[model samples]
Target chain A: MDKPALAAWLGAEITGMALLSGGAIQQNWALDVLAGGQAQRWVLRTDAAATLAVSRSRAEEFHLLRAAHAAGVTVPEPLRLCTDRSVIGAPFFIMRRVDGLAAAHRVVRSETLAGGRQALVAALGRELARIHSIVPPRADLPFLGEPASDPCRRFVAAMRVLLDAGRLPRPMLEWGLRQLEISAPPPAATVLCHNDFRTGNYMATEAGISGILDWEFAAWGDPHEDIGWLCARCWRFGGPGEVGGVGPRAPFVAAYEAASGRRVDPARVAWWEIAAAIRWAVVAIDQAERHISGAEPSLELALTGHIVPELELDVMRAVMARAA
Target chain B: MSWDGHEAPDTRALLEIARTTLMEAVIPALTGDARFKALMVANAMAIARREDGPAAAAVHAAVRELGDVAALCAAIRAGAHDPGSADHDRIAASLRALAEARCRISAPKALG
Candidate 1:
């Protein structure tokens, strides 16, 4: 849409605009505007064409966001959701603009931010514990499903589908399947898991975590899945001795244990961490397919493809080590 | 230089060529496409640049070192090295050694 049309629709004069990173499923924008001569900022999130396949509809995402917010997870407040494709050529949602930073690389490496890394990681663990405490609605949330007894089985099944589709490494497939059989974690109480909880998906300031962003992958599952994912090595950027590339694993786990009043099982967390690596590998391949299939020829997807082997190696090494 | 006999060029070599093409060819041609298309190209470029610049070398070095650790484990299993009789402790020591080795490799220049 043109600037004038967007201004008319938003009822504000747009002063500055910056395009945020667009994922496979959504286009995001940072819009600075003036209303009644007072400056305001809002995030404009719109669906990308490819996102229609794997994503919940805008209405569903909005509803889920509302539910999650009500359950007390820190998130950007939803303002308005517009499903009219005529306005912007896609469904879009507007939300209150959040301040602070989201770039993981910057946060992990910067000396200024490095000092607070431990505190931030601990805070993140507590926040995740809180999110997992939310009870799934019996019927109102139609999309939420029961937690599987063996998430590894589900992962293996999904990987088989992808492998059968071709373009995936056979060795990695075999290795993952073997690992799944040998190193599966014991089942625990199912709870709401922010499936994509990681460094890049969160907003942070000097004080600590402000909000967790990106809810497209949220689901009902083993809560420890989120914990392990948060500590996955891939998400650690380049920071050594840090779980999420922020701080040591002990503090992160300790903070969660203290907050939730439950013993954090190291073995279970390790299992999920390995699973997290495998999941990333699968997602990386999907991103590569997006480029190779001509749906969206992105260097990002191609680069993402390169990481699959590394991820596969991590998964193999972790699982093998655990088995031994 | 070849660790596991895979004939394909290492990730570093492959990504350098791809990154060059992306920056010199693809990014400049992204005008007038749908917003999503443009975004995809841009995101792709970011990933390519990151891989070409830092992640490729870092991951390659890490993997090669891990392979060495695996070889060490094999040696210990064959009784070539006295890593102790306890299998669990042997594996744990090997892993710790690998982690320390990885930490010594200078942080990727590009990531800096």
Candidate 2:
């Protein structure tokens, strides 16, 4: 979209605009605007060329951002959602842009983060607890799909469906899913799960977490699902610690329990961690399929698919650890 | 380098050169996303080089012995390799080997 059109639409003067990288499924534009005779920075989020099957629309993401912001969860303040595609050739939303680093490699490898990692982990745990506190059965978040009656069983079924539909057969994933199904834990209390909570999904500063980003895959499921996903080996980005690759899992869990007033089961978290690896592997396969099928020819997507073996190894190791 | 009935710089050799050039030359010159993409390119070329070399042979031998992945997946899915069963360890070992081979191609650093 042209700056003039966007400026007219927002009744603001566009000073600067730049497309931010790092988002694979969506486009984020950093825009400096002179609105109400004051200079302000905003982020414009829109759909990418292609997106995953489970992502939410721009309007839905806007609503989710608003809900999260209201729930004391640090999130970019959603300003406006433009559902009219005519404005930008696609639906988009504008929000207050916060300054922080969201790069996985940087967050995992930055030496300066040594002091902040503990606080960041604890803060992330508290923030996640706050997010999970947003229970559903509400009229506002109608976009959220129905809560999974049994998240583990549902995940196993979904994995099977994904595997069966694909031409490629993943024996390790199949075995891992079977094990998960066999020892599936009883469903815990359902809540608003940030289904993609992981190391790279949030922004962090030297002080602490700036904001949690990417709510495209948000769903209502067991809270442990998010916890496991956060601690999953595949999402650790080769970091040393398990708490989102930043710190030990204990402080994070303790902070979470303190914030939520609920106890977390380590064994259940381990089960979901194994499931998380399989889930990521399936997603990676789908990403590669997008590239192979000429739907979205991205080298990143193709390379992403190659990570499935590592994920499969993780699943096997997790399963073995459980058995031991 | 000598050529008998083939070119001196084979595909694998070409890929290795490309990867080394990208990592040592192009990557250092770039910054931010471009550098990251360059690293990925280097990794891809390295994997291709490995695949073009002896990696494919080992993988094929394993596949020939264990049958195709589809059959193994089907068997595992059908409860043939149930955890703790007699066949489970063998199946797990095979899968681990397959994963290690692929990792050697994709990200050998991960193997450590």
Candidate 3:
């Protein structure tokens, strides 16, 4: 909705509205609302100019956020979901804007963070475990589909589908996916896995992580999937350390095991890390195609396509390392 | 019509100048959102400069024998170059060369 209309709907006066950056699929606006002589700040999230094929709608993300909040996961408190497009020209939701840096590059390199890297990574591990604690069949999260019999296979198949849909066969990605299929581990325990639970997706302060953002890619799968994705090299943003470019894998895994009471297999984590590279590579190509296909002509998207080579190299190097 | 003797700047030189101008002069003056957008513009210009340079062509030529990345990968996926085979070593080396070429243009520091 327009600011004035939204203000009326909320029974408040609009103090200010500023667009916030860093949402590729959504546009976030900092909404300053004054109601009953009280000032409050909120975030209004709506659709981007062009949305990714894999992203969840704002309504779905709202429900997911609510469920996560109820499960004790750190997330922005979702206040309302407005599905009527006429209300805002597109679906949108509002949440209390929390403080912290969610930028991946800044989060990894920021020396301002206190308690050092160990505390930050440990907090992230704990948060991820809490998110996994929210299992399915709940009344609130009926949209979460059934668990896959072999989640790895299903994941690889999904990548293949994306590649086929692009009509541009990518051999390196296909090779990695084929290897993943061949070495697909037997299904481990299924839980809610934040498929993109990496360094870039969470917000952290100098004290520690404030909240985990972005739930569009959450899925029912092996919990270790989240662990591996978090530690993947690509998400490290060229940092020296692993564990989301903050620390070693040992402490991160230890923290997660402590929080969830689940034993982690190092080999399985490595396997999933390999899968993370392949998945990211495919996504990179898809992002590039959005520009190349004239769907969205953006310099960022064009440059993003060029990143596929780097991701493909990562995939090859990862597979070779595993073999070695 | 008389032509001027002075040479015009090529695309790479022009892009480099634009990038440096944004970074050194324009960026320092910009703040907040404008600064961020200027940074992005500078980055895009830098990439354009590199992409317009000969290094990008070297990347293409490095993998020219492979027909295309997709075809090369298809060969690898089809078991024509499994890890233990002789073809695997050749393919791996070619891929390494290709990767090095790409990183040189996109992220030269990463190659180091």
lDDT of 1 by residue, A260-320 (tens): 7767788778777877887787777788888888878766566566566556556656755
Report the C-alpha lDDT of model 2 over B1-112, residue by residue, as the tens digit. 5558876588877887877888887889999788878888887787778877676776666566567778788877778888768888877777777777777777677688
Q: How many Å off is the CA of A31 in candidate 2?
A: 1.1
Clashes in predicted model 2: 0
Retained native contacts per candidate, as fractions? 0.05, 0.62, 0.38
lDDT (tens digit, per residue) of candidate 3 on B36-71:
777767766776677887888888887785676776
Q: What DockQ does candidate 1 score?
A: 0.08
Residue A176 alpha-carbon offset, candidate 2, angstroms: 0.6
Best by lDDT: 2
Candidate 1 whole-model C-alpha lDDT, 0 to 1 = 0.68
Model number with the top TM-score: 2
DockQ values of all predictions: 0.08, 0.68, 0.40
Ranking by lDDT: 2, 3, 1
- Name the runs in model 1 displaced over 4 angstroms: A2-15, A34-38, A111-115, A138-140, B1-112
Error of 1 at A22 (Å): 2.6
Which window of ten consecutive residues has the lowest lDDT sum in model 2 chain B? B57-66
Q: What TM-score, to 2 decimals, does candidate 2 have?
A: 0.95
Worst 10 residues of 2 chain A by lDDT: A110-119
Candidate 2 is graded, for docking, as medium
Model 1 Cα displacement at A161 (Å)? 2.2
lDDT of each: 0.68, 0.85, 0.79
The candidate that achieves the highest DockQ relative to the unseen native structure: 2
